[model samples]
Target: MNRLDIIQALMGQKNLKNYLEIGVENGHIFFRIKSTFKIAVDPKFIFDATRRFGKSIINPYNLNNQYFEKTSDDFFAQDAQRVFSAKKLQLALIDGMHEYQFALRDVENVLDYMDDNGVIIMHDCNPQTAGAAGCFNDWEVGEWNGDVWRTIIHLRSQRPDLNVFVLDFDQGLGIITKNKPESTLLFSPEQIKELTYNELVQNREQWLNLKSADYFYNYFDLQRP
Candidate 1:
């Protein structure tokens, strides 16, 4: 399933109405979610702030959405609690800065306000190539995954209370839940950062708890689209 499909499935299954999306550059995915309460955070939005990309602007669901043109850190520190005062977050997408530290902090910060049944979906957790996974400064252009996979490794290794895994599609969508983890990492956080992409290729299944598309379908008992 695509990102939207996975999200919508969870939305229906969990009865999730509150949503938060980090890195809503163009609102390609943000506006698509018909949530009751939603918040969009991004350092700078690329599209016209007043107009919808392709959807209707008059939909009342859109009116419930809030936008913050600030870094995820800034948003959390400055106004996160105030905006989310009435409702806890049920779903969140971490797609802001692709760097490991930023992505790591984004997940941690969101976890603080997540609802009991909440889930967090992290994008770009499996860079397909060295160029795709290169350190941020060395990136020239094109698709830059930028060491984000490291965050998955970090979470899996550091946060045993959270179940972590990756669906091996769409640059490897990382799934995080506060359920009991089936396994814990043997590697330390420092050793995890020292790991190379080649090593990841060899240990992807074990390290990322990689799953097939059917695994998700069966896990959630949701029919494939």
Candidate 2:
């Protein structure tokens, strides 16, 4: 499915109120949600006016959204729990730091703030297709490896009670619901192990070649400018 379809599904969900987005390169998706309050987190300091397309002048008028310029990990570690307590998040989208560990942390942080019935939409699960091209159609600014997939695989094993659906199309979106899901759809430990193993084998070469170690070593050296 496309972004529009994702938005429609979110809109159709019952009792949705506040929304949170981990990576807001611009306010494109933020503006689409029409929520009373939107909290967008990104480390990038410069908000590209071009993201507003040719309608740049009209964009600043949108004041319902608030932007927090900080790395996703830092933002969550410092303030996520507090924010969640203040506003029970109805919807959350995680599109930041697509490394396996980072993605896993992002999910954990979002869940900390999400209401029991709330749903989360994870982006960039299809690394071979749409995400490979480095742009996620009209909704994203750049691409990263499908680390969220690895996280999902881990969560499937670690949290058997959570509802996880790997949507088949549009860059392989993953929908996770906190609501008590039907037991029939849940995955077994063996199945989770198999899936995770397969993914590791399939991406072993790329995984080994990743600059994750160096990235983290000099992480603070790199600032969003």
What is the Å distance of residue 45 in model 2 from its true position? 5.1
Error (Å) of candidate 2 at residue 143 is 6.0
Model 2: ten consecutive residues of lowest lDDT = 216-225
- Tens digit of per-residue lDDT, candidate 1, span 1-225: 677888988887657778999999988888889887889999998877457523446555777678899999999999999988888999999989998889999999999999877889999988888778868898887889888888888888889789988999988899898988888787787897799889988987888899888988776677776
lDDT of 2 at 19: 83
Which candidate leads in TM-score? 1
Backbone clashes under 3 angstroms, per model? 0, 0
Candidate 1 Cα outliers beyond 4 Å, as residue runs? 52-59
**Full-model lDDT for every candidate:** 0.86, 0.60
**Alpha-carbon shift of residue 184 in model 2 (angstroms):** 9.3
